[model samples]
Target chain A: MSLTIAIPKGRLGTQAIEMLKSAGVGESIDEKSRKLVFKDENRNLNFILLKNSDVITYVENGIADMGISGKDMIMENSADIYERYKMNIGRCKMSVAGIKGKRVFNDDTIIKVATKFPETAKKYFNGKGQKIKIIKLNGSIELAPILGLSDVIVDIVETGNTLKANGLEVFEDMYNISAMIISNKISYKFKRKEIKEIIELIRKEDTE
Target chain B: MNFLNIEDEMKYFQKMFLLRKEIENYLYEEGYLNIEPSIFEGYDEFTGINSRINRKSTVKLLDNNSEILILAPDITTGIVNKFLPRWEYGKKLKIFYYGKTYKHNGIGIKENREMGVEIIGEKNQNTDQYILSTAKQIISRYSNDFLLEIGNSKFLKGIMQSCSFNKEEYDNVMNLLYSKNRQDLKDYLSNLPFKNAMSTLLNILDLEGTFDEIKEQVEGLYLNELMQQGVEELSKIDNYMKNITDKVTYDLSMVSELSYYDGIIFRGYIKGSNKEIIKGGRYDSFTEQYGYKIPAIGFTVELDELIKVLDKEEQR
Candidate 1:
C-alpha cells in the first residue's frame, strides 16, 4: 500500500521536503503552486500540504497515514493519535510570557492567559494546580499582555525577539517544542513496517 | 450532516435492519440465544467494582430514592452483572444481544448500536477458537478487507510486574505506551533503576510485524513467571491464527485500559474506517467482581460504525 504523509506548508515543510529528497521518500513540493497534494508514483508516497495545525487532524482521522507537526500542535489537541517519532526540526520552547517586571504565575490570583493553544494552556496550568482563564488568540499574542487583554501568554517561543519587541519577557518555560511525526493508532498498526522504514530512512539522511 | 430526508432515513433503517437480521440469524444457528439488555443500571453498584468506567461520560440520573442510575454505557458489563450475581457452577450459557449504549463525548451524547455474544462456563482452547472464528466471520461479512489486531492483557501486566514501577511511574509509562512516544519513554527509563526491564519494555514497545514475528519477538523478551503465563495463553491459539497473517497483527505493547479484561484482547478495523468497528476480550476476572468466578469471552460489533462504513462504500 502507498503511504500518505501530511506536511505543514511553508518553511518547516520546505525543510521537510529537503530532508525527504535525501531520504528518497516524497515528490518535489511547490509551496507557491495552487496544487495542495503531490503524489510520487516512483517512491510510492503521497504528500498533503496542510496548515501546521491541520496536520494532526488529517492524521487523527486517518485521512493521512502519518503527519509532520510541532510538539506545540501535539500538546494542543486531545486527539488520540500516536506521537511516533521526533524529527526535532523546528526546535523551540513553549513559555509563559508576561510584561517585564510583573509576576503572573506565583500568586493565587485567577490570571487570564492568552494563547493559540487553549487546551495546551489549560493542561499546563492544570499540572501546576493553578487557576487560569484562557483567552484564545489567533495572531499577535504578545499584544495581549501589553494591551491588558491577558495577564500572560502561553505560546511557542522561537528567538524571544517577538516577546522582546512587544516589551514582554518569558516568565516560565513549559515545554521544549520541536517537529514530530505522528500516526493514527490503527494506521500505525497496519503500516508499521512502512512507517518504520520511512523514519529510518529520514534518520539516515539526518545523520548524513 | 443531519439534513437527510425521510426517504434517506428510512433506507438507512432498512439497510441496518437487514444487516442485523443476517447477523441475528447466524447467532441463532450457532446456538447463541438473543437477549435484550436493560437501558438503565445502578451507577454506584458498577463503579464500586470497576474504576475504569468513565464517570463523566456516563449519563447519570437521580432516582426517586435519590440514588444514582446510569444509562447502560456498555452491553458486556450489563450481561455479566445479570449472570454473575446468581450464577451456578458448570452452568453453560451462550447468548447474543443487540443494544444501544450511550456515551457523552466532549461534543455531545452519542448512542452506539452494538451486537455482541458471550460464552460462559468455558475456559479451554476450543472456546477461544470458537469466539475468535465467530468474531472474524462477523467482521469479514461487513468488510472483506479487515484486520483483527490481538494482544494479551497478561503480557502487559506481567511486564509491569517485572519492572517494579510504583503507581505513578506505571501510569506515566502507560501514557507513554498509549501515545507510542519513544523519546519521553527513553528519557524516563534512563533515570529508572531497572535496567533489564527498561530494555525489554522498549523492545516490546517497538514490537510490530506479522503474527509469527510477534510470537518470536514476544518469546525473546525477558520472561518472569507472570510473563511466561501470558506467553502460554497466547501460544495456545497462535498456531491456528498463523494462516491469516496478513489479516492480523499481535504485539505486547498493545495496551487497553479496560481493566476487566484478564486475558486475550482484540480490536477489529476495516479499510476506510479510522475507528475500530469491533472490540472484545476475555473477562473472567471481571466476572469475579460479582463474587462468582466463571470463564467468559465475548466480542461486540459496533453496528453504527459498521453502517457508516457500508454507507460510504455504497456511495463510492
Candidate 2:
C-alpha cells in the first residue's frame, strides 16, 4: 500500500512538491496538472491536494497518513497530530496591523479587531491584557481598519505590500509562519522507520 | 438525505444503546452501582457550587413561585450535590449514570453526546489506575489501536510555582505548550533563566514513545522538588497503568482546560481523529466547592467517536 501524503494547495503546495521531489517522491506530482490525487507507481506514494487549514484535519483523521501545512493553521486548530518536521518554506509573520495613527491601547475605549483567524486574534489581544471585540472577516482584512470596521487586523504578512497598499501599518508581530510536515500519531508510531527515512531524505536535500 | 431516515436513525440509536449497555455492564461487573437523579435542580446547585457549569450552558427557567431551576448539564455535579451527602460511610463509591444532559450550548450534539461512569470516594492512585485501566479494556474490546495520553495538573502548577511568571505570561506559555507550538514555546522560554530546563520539560511533554522511553526521559529531568513530586506521582500511575495496558503514554506538560483538576488528567485517542475519544481527570477540588473536600477522578468516552472510528475501519 502507498503512503497517502496531503500537500496543501497554494504557495506552500509548490514548495511542498519540490521538497517531496527532492525526497525522491516527486514523480507522483505533476506541477501543471489540476488533478487532486497523484500517484507514484514506482515509489507507491500518493499525494493529495487539500486546503491549507484542512491539511491537519485530513492527517489527524487518518484520511491522509501525512500532510504539509502552515504552523499558524496547526496552532489555531490545535489538532493532536504529530509535527514531524518544520519545512521553513512560505515564511511569513502573523501580525496585528492597524491604521497608521490609531491608538491600540486606550483605557477608556475598547479596540475592535478583524481577522480571518478569530481564535489567534482573540488570544493575542487577551495576552496583551486588553479586551477587544473580534470581528471575523474572510477576506480583505486590510479594508477593515480603513473602513473603520476594526481598530486592528490580525493576518499573515509576507511582504507588507497589502498593508501598505491599504494604508495600514504592522503594529505587532505575533509569531513567524512556516510550513510544517505532520503525520497522524498512529502513522508515526506504526511507520516510524519509513517516516524517519523520508524525514532524513527531506532534511538532507533541503540542507544540500 | 435518505441515509438519515427513520430506519438509519433507529439503527444508530440501537448501536448506541447497546454500547451504553456494554459500558454499564462492564462498570457493574467492576462494582459500580447505577445512580440516576432528577433532571432538574436548583440553579444555585449548579452555579453557586461548581463554576464549571457556565451560566450560558445551563437551561434556566422559573418554577411555579418564580424560584430559579436549571436542567442538569452534567450528572456528576448532580450526584455530588444530591447523592453523596446521603452516603454516611466512607466506602468506595462507584456510580454509573446514563441520561440526557441538557446544555444550552449543546456542544456535544453527536460525538459529544455524553454518557459514562464517575467513581467517587476513592482518592488512591489505585483508583485512578483502575478507572483508566477499565476504560482501556472497554475501548480495546472495540478497537486495539488506541493511545491514552496522561498528565498531571500538579505538574503544570509546579512548573508555574518554580518560575517567576505573572498570569499573562503563565497563560501564554500554557496556551503555547497546550497547542504544541514548539517554536513559540521555545522562543518564549529562550530568554528565561531556566530556558534549557523548560525546553527539556517541553520536549519531555511532547515525547511520544514506548513506556521505557517515557520513563527514561522523565527520570533524567533536573526538576524542582515540587515538580519531582509530580513526576513521582505520574511515574507511580504510569507503572500501575503498564500492568493494565501498554498503550498508556505519559506527557508531563499536558494541561487541562478545566481549572478544577488538581491532580491527574488524561485523554484517549484512536489511530486517527482530531479530538480525544475520551477525556477525564482528577478534580479533587470538585467536592471542595460543595464543602466536602473529597478527591475524585473519572472519565467519559464519547462512544459516538469510537463508533465512527470503528465504522471507518469497517469500511476500509
Candidate 3:
C-alpha cells in the first residue's frame, strides 16, 4: 500500500511539492488541476492538497496519514498530532504591527486591534496590561491601521514588505514560523519504519 | 452497526463494571476505602473548582422548592463538599470512587465515567511522592510505554506573584508559556522591568532534559526562595520515582486544568497519543468552600481514553 501525505496549499505547497520530488517522489501535482488528490505511481505515494490550517486537523483526525503545516498554526489550534520533523522552510515571524510614527499607548484603553490571529493579538495586548477590542479580519490586516479601524495588527512578516508598504512597523515579534511535518498519532506508531525512512530521505535532501 | 444498540450497550456496561471492580480492588489494597455521595450538590460548592468548567458547562436545575442544584461535574468537589466532612474527624482519609460526572455540552465526556483516589489530610512532600509513585505503579501495570509528566503549578504561581502581575497579565503569560510560544514569552518579558528574572525563569521552563540534568541546571541559577523550594521538592519526587520506573519526567511549563491547584500536578500519557489518559494534582484550598480546611491530592483515569490507547497499541 502507498503512503498518503497531505501537502498544504498556497506558498508552503510549492516547497512541499519540491521536497517530495527531492525525496524521490516525483511531482504529479498539476498546477491547474482542480482535483485534490495526486498520485506518483513510481514512488507509491498519494498527495492530498489541503489548506494550511486544516493540515493538522486532517492528520490528527486520521483522515490523512501525514502532512506539513506551520508550527504557529499547530500552536494556535492546539491540535493533538505528532510532530514528526521540522521542514525548516516557509520561514516567517509572527509580529505585532502598528502604523509608523504613531505613539503606542501602554495604558488600559480599549485599543482596537485587528488580525486573523485573534488569540495572538489578544495575548500581546493583554500582557501589556491593556484591555483590547479585537477586530477580526481575513485579508489585508494592514488596512485596519490605514483605515483607522484598529490601533494595531498581528500578522506574519516574511520580508516586512507588505507592512512597510502600508506604513506599518513591527512593534513586537511573537514567534518564528516554519513548515513542520506531522503524522497521525496512530499512523506514526503503526507505520514507524516507513515514516522514519521518509524523514531520513527528506533530511538528507535538506542537508545537500 | 450502531454500538449504542441495547445488546452492545449491555456488553459495554458489563466491561465498565468489571473495570470499576478492578480499580476499587486495587485502591483497597493500597489502603483506600470506597466513598459515594449524592449526585447533586449546591451551586456554591463548585465555585472555582475547575477553570475549564465554567458556569456554562454546569448542568443547573431547580428542585421543587426552586433551589439551585447542579449535577456534579467533578468528583473532587463532591468529595470535598459532602463526603470528606462525614469522614472521621482528626484522622487521615484515603478514598477511592467510580462515578459519572455531568457537563452541559463541551469539556470532557458528556457524562464522564471516572475512577479515582483521593488522599486527604497531611500536607507534606512524602504524600506527594507516595501518590505519584502509586499512580505510576497502577498505570504501568496496565501499559508499559506510558509517560508520566510531573509539574509544579506552585512554581508558576510563585513566579507570577513575585512579578506582581495582574490577572490579565498572568493569564496571558500562562497562555503563551503553555503553548510553547517562545517568541511571545520573549516579547512579553521584554516589556517588563524584571526582564532578567523572567528570562531566567523562561529559560528554565524551556529546558527539557532528564530529572537530574534539569535539577543541575536549576541549581546554577539564582531563584527566589519559593522557586528554590519547589525545585527541591520536585527533585526529591523525581529521585524517588527514578528507582521505580523510567517512564516519569518533569515538565516545568505544564498548565493545569484547575487554577486552584497549589502544588504538583501530573498527567499520564501513553506514547503516540496526544490526549492525557490520567490527570490530577494537589489542591490544598479545594475544601475551603465546604467550611473546613484540608490538604488533598488525587487523580482520575479516563478509562475510555486508556482503552483507546491500548487498542491502538494492540493493532500496531
Question: Each candidate's root-mean-square deviation in Å?
Answer: 2.1, 4.5, 6.8
Candidate that scores best on DockQ: 1
Top candidate on TM-score is 1
What's the CA error at residue B70 for candidate 3, in Å?
A: 3.6
Report chain B TM per candidate.
0.93, 0.80, 0.88
CA error at residue B134 for candidate 2, angstroms? 1.8
Tell me, by lDDT, which candidate is best: 1
Report the C-alpha lDDT of model 3 over B48-106, residue by residue, as the tens digit.
46654468778888899898889987778777777556756566888888787788765
What is candidate 1's lDDT per residue for B1-316, written digit by digit as tens? 2536988888888988999999999999999998989888889876765565678888889999999998888878788888788888899999999999888987988888989999988888888878888888888887788988888888788788878898778888988888988887888888889656566788777565565676667666677777677777777767777754458777767777556888888889888888888898888888776667899999899988888899898889
**Clash number for each model:** 0, 0, 0
Please report, as a residue range, the 10-residue window in candidate 3 chain B with the lowest summed lDDT. Answer: B200-209
Ranking by DockQ: 1, 2, 3
Ranking by lDDT: 1, 3, 2
Residue lDDT tens for model 2, A30-112? 86788889888786678899888889998988888888889889878767777667766878999988988775754457888
lDDT of 3 by residue, A169-198 (tens): 998788778777777755554455576677
Q: Which of the two candidates, 1 or 3, achieves a greater lDDT against the reference?
A: 1
